[model samples]
Target: MTASTLSAHHVGITVNDLEELLAFYRDVLGLTVVDRFAVGGDAFADAVGVEEGRAEFAHLEAGGIRIELVEYDPEARGSPAAGLNQPGATHVGLAVDDLEAFYADLPESVSTISEPRTTESGTSILFLRDPESNLIEVLES
Candidate 1:
């Protein structure tokens, strides 16, 4: 039997601070906010493997891709290793038209691993951390 696999639904990032993450993704990164909702009660707790769980979710869209940012009341926090070589390390990749311009305008609150580096293939890549310290890989080709 053929394996059933559909296209990705969305990329979900668990965050401790919802407001700050929203501002970074929406205002700084220029993603559009599509929806916002709050979930809790029995079903939520069961699905999350927690005795009690409540969360606020914000959905943002960029380049036709959806990014779901969620904040839990109990505050689930984890940082994938500082380097990308670690197992289970994950990051969201984004593309920009002008990486230099974007970097120049970045606020001090934003943390960048380094300035954009252009590979021999003429593709520029940058690594940045969100307010929650989640990694985001940005490229311009």
Candidate 2:
């Protein structure tokens, strides 16, 4: 028997600084800003399961997926690393057409934990830490 697999729609991440995030994801990494909305209005709050208030968010499209960058009023802090040995919280993997050029374009904002290298699978990949300390995988497939 065959069953359908779940498809990921979008991933929402809370950010304290929208400007920094936008610069990293949009300017540095080159994700397209598809849309944006200010969090307010009871309808919008209810829909997203949050209390009504003046929050702000940006919808970014990267590699055919949606990334919601939210700045909630009374902003929330990002999670601490799960553990040094374990993979840090959630990571978003991005496919780069040109790994070298991409690495060259990265701003000082994102720290390169490891430089670009080839995996056993012959995949060229690298790890980066975002401003919020979230791990990001840049791979060439």
User: Model 2 segments beyond 4 Å from truth?
Assistant: 1-6, 41-54, 82-88
Put down candidate 2 lDDT per residue, 13-132, tens digits, no spaces. 778898888778887778999988885788877776666545788989987899888888755555767433576457778898888888887776678877899989899998897787
RMSD of 2: 3.5
lDDT value, candidate 2, whole model = 0.80
Worst 10 residues of 1 by lDDT: 74-83
Predict model 1's lDDT versus the native. Answer: 0.89
Best by TM-score: 1
The Cα local distance difference test for each model comes to 0.89, 0.80
Residue-level lDDT of model 1, residues 63-140, one tens digit each, is 978999998887755566767788988888998999999899999889999999998988899999997788999998
